[model samples]
Structure formats: C-alpha cells, structure tokens
Target chain A: MSRDALQESLSAVMDNEADELELRRVLNAFDDAETRDTWSRYQVARAVMHKDLLIPRLDIAAAVSAALADEAVPAKAARGPWRSLGRLAVAASVTVAVLAGVRLYNQDEIAGAELAQQTQQPVMAGPQVKGPAVLAGYKESADTTGPMANGVLQGQSGWQDQRLPGYLRQHAQESALKGTESALPYARAASLENR
Target chain B: MRAIPLLTLLLSGWFALPAHADEAQDWLTRLGRAEQQQSFQGTFVYERNGSFSTHDIWHRVQDGQVRERLLQLDGSAQEVVRLDGRTQCVSGTLVAGLGNSRDAPSRALDPQKLNQFYELAVIGKSRVAGRNAVIVSITPRDQYRYGFELHLDRETALPLKSLLLNDQGQLLERFQFTRLNTSVVPDDRELQPSNDCTPIAVANSKAPEVQSTETWHMEWLPPGFQLTNTSARKDTQTKATVDSLMYEDGLARFSVFLEPISDASVTETRTQLGPTVAVSRRLNTVDGEMMVTVVGEIPIGTAERIALSVRGEKKPAAQP
Candidate 1:
C-alpha cells in the first residue's frame, strides 16, 4: 500500500469511523515500523482531544497485543458439516478474551462486573439492606470478580449450584453476626430465606 | 440481527415516559421509611443459591420509638431483636463483624445521596405477597454501580420486595416479604435476639490505624468515590504491615490493601466464589516490592485499574 493510503487508513481508524476494509488495511501494515509510528502518533492526537493522559512512546498496544497473542489459537474455519467445531473454537477464544478483560473491567465496576459485554447479559442483585446502626459498608462492593463474570455458569453443574448458596449464606451470616449493622446483616441473612 | 429493531422500539417506548421516574423514586423513599414507622409483622422467607430460611418478624412503633424483632421459625431458633435500627440481642449462628451494642453509628438509607449514583424510575407495577404493588427501578448512572427494582406496598409505601439487577436485567438476588401486616404489633418477648445471640467484638479485631499520608496514595479513582478510612495493621505472626484504605461512593464501597511480599513467589491470583472479586497485582514502589490486592464486588477491569493506580505517596514516580 502507498504511504498516502496507509495514512488515510490511519486517520479513519483514529476517528473510529473506519470500515472493516480500512481496519484490515491498517492492521495488515502494522508490522512496518513507520506505519506503527504513524499509528501511535494518530492515537496520541486522538487521546489529546479526548483529554486522556497520553504517555509519549508508551507501548500499551504492545502490552495488549502480547496479552492477546499468548491466548490466541488457530481458529477453525467455518465450513459445512464441521461448523460445530468452528463454533467451539470461537467459544474457547471468547472465554480467553473475557477472562483477561474481566481483570481490567473490575476497577470501575465494584460488584457484579460483567465481562464479554458484547455477548453476555449483566447480572443483577436484590435490594441492599443496611445493618442496624453499627456502621454502614458497601458489602463486598469491590468483589465484582464473582462466578457470573467467569462465564462458567453457562455449564454450571449441580455441584456449583449447591456449594455457592452455602458459601453465600455462610458469608452473609458471618458478616451480619461479626460486623456492625445488626439489622441489615440480619436482614441480609434472613433475605436468603425469601423464596 | 432481526431483533435489533424490536429492541430499539421497546427501548424508545421505555424512555418515552419521563414523569414515571419521579413516581418511582417516591415509592423508593416510602419503602425506605416503611420498616421504621410502620408496625407490621409477618413471616418472610429468604432464598439465594444453596441457603434458604424462614423467619417471623414483629415490628412496633409507639411514641416515635420503633422496636423490632426477628425469629427463624424453622430449623434453628435464629433470632434477633432491635430498637430503631440497633441490634439489641441475637440467637443462632450470628456470624461476626457486627459492631458492639452501644458503639458504631448506624448509617441509614439516605435516598437523596443514593440518587447520585442511581437513576430512580417507576418502570411499572407488579404484585407481591398477595398485594398490589408499584415497581420502582433504580438504574445506575455509571458502570461502577448496579441497578435495583423495588416493589412497594401501595398503601403504606413500604417495600414488600426488592430486586437487584444488572444492565441486562439478569436477577442477581431478591428480597421480598412473603406475608406482611401493618396493623399487628408483637409483644415485648418477640423483640429479642436468641439465647446464643452474642454481641459482636469490634475492639478485638479493630482495624489498624493509618499513621500518615507519607506512605502511599491512589493515582486514580472513579469520580464521586472518596477515601473514608485508612489503616495499617501489623500481623502479629508475620510482622508484616498491611495497609488498607477504604473508599465509598455513598452507596458503593471498596477497599485497597497493600502489603510487602519479600522474596515470596506468589503468582497473580483471582477468585470469585459468589458476588466477591479478589485481585492481587505485584507492583514496585519506593518502599520496595509490594503486592496490591483489591477485594470487592466490582468488575475485574476496574479492579485492575485500581491495583495499578496504587502509588507510594512518598514517591509517585515509583510505578510498575
């Protein structure tokens, strides 16, 4: 590709208005040092406009690429009767991507943090009942890395279903008894009985 | 692909009713006050994953004084009694961590403050516990918070049921009163924690006291979240100082713990048994090599960012 075409492709990507063809063109030329530099420059410019902190020459893309590369598998091609195999390959890749993405997404979303946002439904919870006047705490607000985010629930067996409730009950009862906010904790523990 | 248009149509119709928001919040405010002022008693059941229990509650409001008691009707005689919102006594398996009887200020539900994080709307109506109810939806304004839907008693404005939901409306947990009566009040005997109800010991496991900000700071935090407490606890056995800082955005809360790992080969670990997420990241600070572990119910990406944002206040340049 000519330098001008590459530059146009880079600009389109920076604007987030690039078509799939344009994205392919830029990604194809990603190996060239000059092209990479230009891409970084465009990213810096865009970052500046968005008021995001721009670390000059920071290789975040390198880190992301490295993270993505290690988990990459040779995806099976979509073909006739063997499409099931290809679907399985896609599912495997998605799980890998989601696991990595979960770690990054947890900081902002403290609880019930959903990953694979594109494919998964966000998990919800019931009302937050405060304990009596001991002290108020956002209970486990930062523990968003629960089972739902792990995406293992799709195939959850009886074992997980059985054990998870026990753990949850134990934790809630323990928190209510051990901590302040007697009423809220008691309510939380009691709420477990609501069918 | 074919459902996108239909979904959009539903969404547009959903957003079209703007006046409904205020109506929903009004119901939520009522539910917040229901238990305090209303004298009601009934048998309620709580269910989650593996645990299920049934309990009877008696609430009395007289001369501006509110007294309440809860008893597990089945299995063990798990029980608790409270005056206003403070626990008086308890029975059965009361875990731990609840503050002492006369100590620790109780934080009430401040609907106004919570409004900052959640958008309140009365989405629709529903029936619960054999009563007509109004559905109040509290939609989170940001990714940091979760949304809630409450079914309030039409007459007393008390919350008969509440549902915590994510953006996609998947139910995580539910709390509802199976049966409630506002006119009935229980006797003095009902408002008591069971015989085994022991008072919580906060003084023994007191949180550590933070010395000074001369130690470390978070480089970034989600807007509206503020640091509420900082402490430094030394493990008696290991003699390691574990620094913990807690932050809350009124409704949502999180804690960051920093500890030194000297020559200890602990790989990065993440675990979530239920609604909790724990993440530990190794970072180099001016004080030497330390591990930053963030435990909360937040998303992993947010936790990762928080882990990376922890910087030594004494040396901001020390980031890895």
Candidate 2:
C-alpha cells in the first residue's frame, strides 16, 4: 500500500502537479530500485505518447550524481614572476589587437572616402572602370548574373532576368509618371533605359 | 574646475548648430517657391552605373502657369511636355492608364515634414552651370531611403545639381546641368510637343477604374510609409492576374507586385540597378504560391524586408 502511494506521488511529480509532500515522497523513493524502474517506464511511456524517440537506458540523474562525486576542486596557484610574465603577454596581445582593429577601421574609412570622391567626379567613367584597382580589372564576363552584392538587386539570371527588367521599367516609369518629384523619377526611369 | 568652461563651450556649440539647420530649412522653402517662379532652360547629364545620358529641360512660368518640356539630347529623342505638372504628350513609348486626369495633386515639399525623416543641412557652396549654388545635404534618418545632396541655385534656389547617395555616401546617380540659361523664358514653340508625340487619352482609360481592394496587405512597413495606390491588371506575357500596390514615404516610393505562379520552378531573386532595388520572394497563401516582387529606389535590405512583410488579407467568416 505504501509502494502504491509512492508510485502515485511519482506520477504527480512527473506531471509537475505535485504538492511539496508528494514531491518529497517521490524523491525519497527515487533510491529504491523498483521505484527507479517504475519512473523510467513512466518516462518511456510519456515519450511514446509525445512521439519522441525513447532511449532505453538514459539514467541522466545517476550519471550527474557520479560526475559530481568524481569532480575535484581546482588548486589555486601561487603568484610568481611567471604570473607577471603571463600578464605582460596578455597586455601585449591586447595592445596588438587594439592597434590592428584601429588600423582596419581606418583603412575601411579611407577606402570609403576614396570611393565617394571617385563617384563625385564629373567625368563619366565606364561602370567597370570604377571601384578599386582589382575590381576595375576584373571583367564581369561571367554568364551567370547572380544576385549583386553592391547594387539594387543581384541574383541568379533565370526567371528574374526575364521578368525583372520589365517590372523595374514599369515601376520606374509609373513612379516617374505618378509622383510629384517629376525630374527625379524621370531621371530614374531614363537611367533604367540606359541599362 | 576645467569641466565648467568645457561644458559651456559645448552647450554654445550645440545651440549654434540649430541656427544653421534653420538656414537649411529656409533654403528648402525657397526651393519650393523657386520651381513655381523661375524660368530656365538647361542641358543636364544624368549618370549612374552602366548608364549615362544628356537631357534638356525647358521650364517656363507665365501668368501663374507652369509649363515644362524635356527631351533627350543624345538618344532617340525621348520627349515629354507637361503643363502644370500634367503630362500633355509623351514620345517613344506610351504608358496606358496613366492619364492626366488620374494624377492626384502633387504634394508640396514641406521642410518641417521632411526634417522628421531627413537631417537637412547646408554643407557648403559650389558653382554649377556657371551659377553660384548652395549645397544642401538631405541625409536620411533611416536605412529605408537614400540621401540626396542638392546644389540649389544661390539666386533662385532652383536645383542646379542633385546627387543621390547610398548609406555609405557613395553616389548612386548624378543629375547636374552642364549649361543653364535663366535669362530668357522659353517661348510657346519650345514648350510645344512635336507632332510625333502621342497625346494620352484621359477620358476613356479603363485601367484606373478597376481597383484591387483587400486582396493583399503588408503585415509591416517601414515607419512613415502609406499606401498611395493599388491596381490589378492582367500580365501581358504570362496572362496571369497581377496585383500591384504602391507606397510612398513623402520622399521615397516603392511598388509591390504579386502574381500567381503557374510554374512552381521559379526561385526567389533580388536585383539592383543604380539606385533602384528589386527583391522577389515566393509567398504561400491559403490559395497557392504567389511570387511577390518589390521594386523601388530603396535599399536592398529594406526591399527584402518589405517583400517578406507582404501578406494576404484575411477573409471574414461567411454568414449562415
């Protein structure tokens, strides 16, 4: 009869609807072999109801207890000249990292500034000729025009290529025709035509 | 002790910046008035990546009436003539359904309203088309729109040059006059459209009458954008029904196009040309799969987000 009461407490605890007394009863009976087996069977049955794969032997609680017992407290080391050397190494690495980060940030800013200046120049340069020295020389001869990285839209050249240009022209033309900013939209439409 | 003087100096500098901002706002106000008042004829070059073209514009204001004519100087003479913001005639290609009568009154540029979305400031001065110009930078407050650096004529406040810039300050497109003459008003002969220019029939256009209501709606849009227009039409090529919705955020505009997919093989795509970004995404609705294409002069990320935010409007329960 007591075993039956303990099993009832186990069921309540598993459902997370247990009172403090029932929870304590299940925890106390957890050391008993038959109760543990009953708990495992209940878990498997719940897993099956939930359509989750039931691992036959997953005693996480016992494994955690064993691990906790085997774990050792870390030993504290004495501070010495070697510790100071380690501190120095850390400081040097941090300084290097900060300096590198600053350098990278500065380079990005400078490159951006240079690009802005190039874009503003009155003379018309070939689209391929703009940008860095590397990209300027890299002819876009690839047949596959995948999504673009820098411009309005870049993607694979299949359905998009077939329909996108028409959609763009229509949108640009309609916007130019509809919106009050007459010249801007017209310019946008005309630009699309140029492409 | 040192902090007191530093704080005072910083406070004064902060106070002085607003004065310059007021000056920029004043210039913008002048620009609005300039378009209605000034008479000018000029040839300007519009340039973007992979495209460059020159165009001539003749804007004349007489007897409180504004008339303008624009013609491509280089290419096959693409031309348009407008009388007071209404297109009278267009050459080369005629866009159906967009007649003069359908045009809602153009919104006047409000510096106050624009200030909410863009930080306007007079950066400096420059000379364009042999005229003294004040450079006004309209930097967008959000990523949804691009920034504009406008070179307004110092005397007339007319935009002599305009540059569209991306978030990185890289120029996407440039519109600047190489030659401008404001002394002489363009005569009626110059303002008149050529014989070949086709007149748009505003009376019997059936396209504007049909509107798509509640077919699709955006789940989320960038703050400040509003639906301006919506239309449903049959796709000429695919023969599929296409629904289009247009939205505007005072300065920027974008169009969302939804077309039912008969072929299930089409994949999502994105494309960019100059300042314009087009993002296409496949959306599964209660009916079937639809391809949503968003095209506009918006950032690619903004376009993509907008494309993803499009959702079909929910149907109400059928009454018994």
Candidate 3:
C-alpha cells in the first residue's frame, strides 16, 4: 500500500471508523517505525483536541512489542512419524499435570468428603451423570468434583460454607427482583434454592 | 485475474455483515417488546454447573400491567410472584435483611446499548418449543463478560431458548422452553400464589434508617458497567452492616458485598456454581478489615478483579 493510504488507514483506526480491510491494512503496517510514529502522533493530536492529559512519549504498543521480541520461542521438533507420537505424549503429560493441579486445588473438598464419610453424614449427591440430551449436545453440567457441586458447597466448614450460600442466594434473589429480562434471573434464583 | 473474485468476496462480506446485524437488532427490539405485549406460559429447564431444575411460568400482560408467577415443578416447591416487574411474594427460605431497593425500577433490555459492548448477529434459524425461531448470537466485545445465544420465537419474538457461553465457548447455563402457549392469556387464578407462597413484606418502617455510612468505590471496573443499586442492610445473624452494590452493563450483572470482618482466621475464597461465581477478598481499611465478596454470573477472573478493586473511600484524618 502507498504511504498516504497507510496513513489514512491508521487515522481511520484511531478514530474507530475503520472497516475490516482498513483495520487489517493498519495492523499489517504497524511494524513500520514511521507507522508507529504516525500512530503516536495521531494519539497526541486526538488527546490535545479532547483536552485530555497524555504523556506524549509513552508508547505502550512499542514497549509490548519490545518485551515480546525479547521472549524466547519454543524450539520446533523435527518432522517424522515420531512427531505425532511425541505430540500425543506431550498432550498426555499436560492432561496429567492439569488433573494433578485440580486434585491439589480441591484438597479441602477431598478432606471435607473424607470427614463426611467418617461422620457417615450423607453428602449432597453430585449432578447426575447423564448424556448430552439438548441441542448441540454440549455437556450441560460442569465438572462435579469441584468445591461446590449441585449448588451445595461441599468440604467447606467455616466462613464460606456459612456466608457464601447466603451471599450467592442474596445476589441471585436481588438480581431476580431487580432484573428486567425476568425469566432467566428467576430461573437462576430458583436453581440456587433447588438444593 | 484473481483480484476480481477477491474483491467481490470482500464486497459480499462487507455488505452481508450489516444486514445480519440489522436483522439481529430488529429481533432484539421485538424481544424487548414481546413481554410487555404478549402473554405466554411455558415449562422451561434451567441448568448450571452442579444444579438442574425445571420450572413452570405463567405470564400475563393486561392493560399495560404485567403479572408473572413461577413455580419449581420438582424438588422444593419454590415459587415467586411478581406484579408489574415488582416482587409480590416468594416461597422457600427468604434471605434475612434483604435490601429494600424496591424503588429502583427494573431496566429493560436495550439492544442499542448492548451493541456498544456486544456484537449482535443473526446466526441462523431454529425450532424451539414447537415454534419456528430465529437464533441471535450476542458475543461480548471484551473478556470481562460472557456471551449469549438466544433463540426467539418467530411469531411472538419471545425467547424460546437462551444459552450462556464463556470465553472458551463452553456452555455455562441453558434456559430453554419445552412448551409455550401464547394464544391463551393466563387467568387470575393461574397467577395466584399457592398456599406455600408467602407474601413479601414491604419493610416500610425501617427504610429511613438504613442509610449506609461508608462510601465504597472501585479502583477499576470493566467498561460499560454502571452502578444500578446500592444498599446497606444489617445482617440478622451477625448484626454487622453489609454494604452491597449491584452493577450491570445492560445484559449482565454482578453484586459486590462488603462487610466488616472481625475473624482473622477467615481466608479468601473463590468458587463457581454453574454460571455464577463467588470470589471473596480481604481488604484492610481505616476502620479494620472488611471482606469484599463479588458474586455474579461473570467469569471468576472478572469477579476476582472486582473483589480486589473494591476500596473504602473513607480516609484516615491525617491523610489530606
């Protein structure tokens, strides 16, 4: 693109008047020093026009770019049938790491469950493990092993167990009472009280 | 030679974008007016993280007045009745010292205002509640809020199904109608609360003395959010005053509650129940330590940010 055209696109982007193509063009040209300088100049001009205070020398985009440039890139693996196997191994390890992280995070919940088991007190049952029945069949229920399952906070004995439920109920009820959309908020509140 | 087709492709996309947006905007406008003008009753199921429940609704609009009654079909027979957007009664355990922001009028769904924060587009057509429907996708412009996919009935413009999705495009909650009958206006008998539905007390006598002494403000907030209501109510059990602020960006809402905490053992907690997330943080103020809990149908990260940003405006006398 011509210098004038690039400058025009930059100004258009600055004013939030750019179409997709103009935005693309401006972003593509952003690596050029002159483009960056023009963009900063436009920012200064706009700020002056709006009577807004601005540190003219401060350029967050340039600083971010510099920091990003300094960051290390992951080395690419050699291409082979082994690459796919290697990727699978990496994925498996990542999954294991994530599961381990979750288990560690839910220590309190596990402890609570153990306490419940020892006490022989019936813990609130988790959401029924059911197959996807709705449209798109995106699983409707989230992971059930977390701190709260089926709207009942589990394994939590102190402040959260007592205050969190009331706070959640209050928030939902207040939203239901104050909301304009009506049904959704009511459903949310009723869902909370279901337990 | 390839330039012509590319130009045509770009031109088509450029032309098609606004048309889809306009169609979606029209559908939203119809939805905003649907509740006020149309009367419908239906059975809908609400599902969140760990909870799922089905409910029946009876909505009637007569002489510019709207009356709605909802009853949980299963589990505890929780019920609520509203007249002209105001809560008239609620069954089941009511939270003690519920704030009296009854004077704050309910806000209407404003598509124009929503457009500022969410990109609205008519995604496709669908069949819902045995009725033809148009699907509208409302994608948030920022990461701070969740997105929604709404299926509105073609004839009535009422929502037949709604899905809330997070940034990863995971469904957080689903509200879909299984049956709807708009042709029949619900009678007064259908709108009446059952014996278990207790009437909501107005609490008019204590209204004047419930003024909040401390002014709390946020250091940062997600763009487009505006404070809709602020209330101070004494906790019935603890007797500590709880200051609450509710914020909304036309479509989504979240509430922040600040209460003085004397217990040093209490730690910050974060948890999510379905679409709603609760994040509590301890804030040290001039008075003492206050627990700031952010509860909302927003992402946990946003809730945590809000919890951390809460600041009591009261300063020590020495700090000018």
Which is the leading candidate under DockQ?
A: 3
lDDT of 1 at A172: 48
Window of ten residues with lowest summed lDDT in model 3 chain B: B1-10
* Selected candidate, larger lDDT, 2 vs 3: 3
Summarize candidate 2's per-residue lDDT along A1-195 as a digit string, tens digits. Answer: 397888888889889999999988888777677888899899878766755533334454454344333332111132677666655555554454455435434434443443454355443235435666434322331211235433234436666756777678768777766754547777777666543
Superposed by TM-score, candidate 1 places the C-alpha of residue A65 at a distance from the truth, in angstroms, of 33
lDDT of 3 at A18: 100
| Candidate 2 ranges with C-alpha deviation above 4 Å | A1-158, B1-18, B202-214, B314-320
lDDT of 1 at A12: 93
Worst 10 residues of 1 chain B by lDDT: B95-104
Superposed model 3: Cα runs more than 4 Å off: A1-145, B1-18, B202-209, B315-320
| Ten contiguous residues with the weakest lDDT in model 1 chain A | A133-142
Candidates sorted on DockQ, descending: 3, 2, 1
* Top candidate by lDDT: 3
Q: Give each candidate's interface RMSD in Å.
A: 11.5, 8.1, 9.8
DockQ of all candidate complexes: 0.08, 0.11, 0.23
Residues B1-320 of candidate 2: C-alpha lDDT, one tens digit per residue = 32244345335433534357788999999988888888989899876655668998999999999898888877677777777777676776543344522466666678898887877788788898999999888877666888888899998898888887777666677788898898999999998889767776632263444333337888889887888777666555676667788888777889998877867789888766667778899998876888999998778889999999999964465334
Please, what is the whole-model Cα lDDT of each candidate in the order they appear? 0.58, 0.71, 0.78
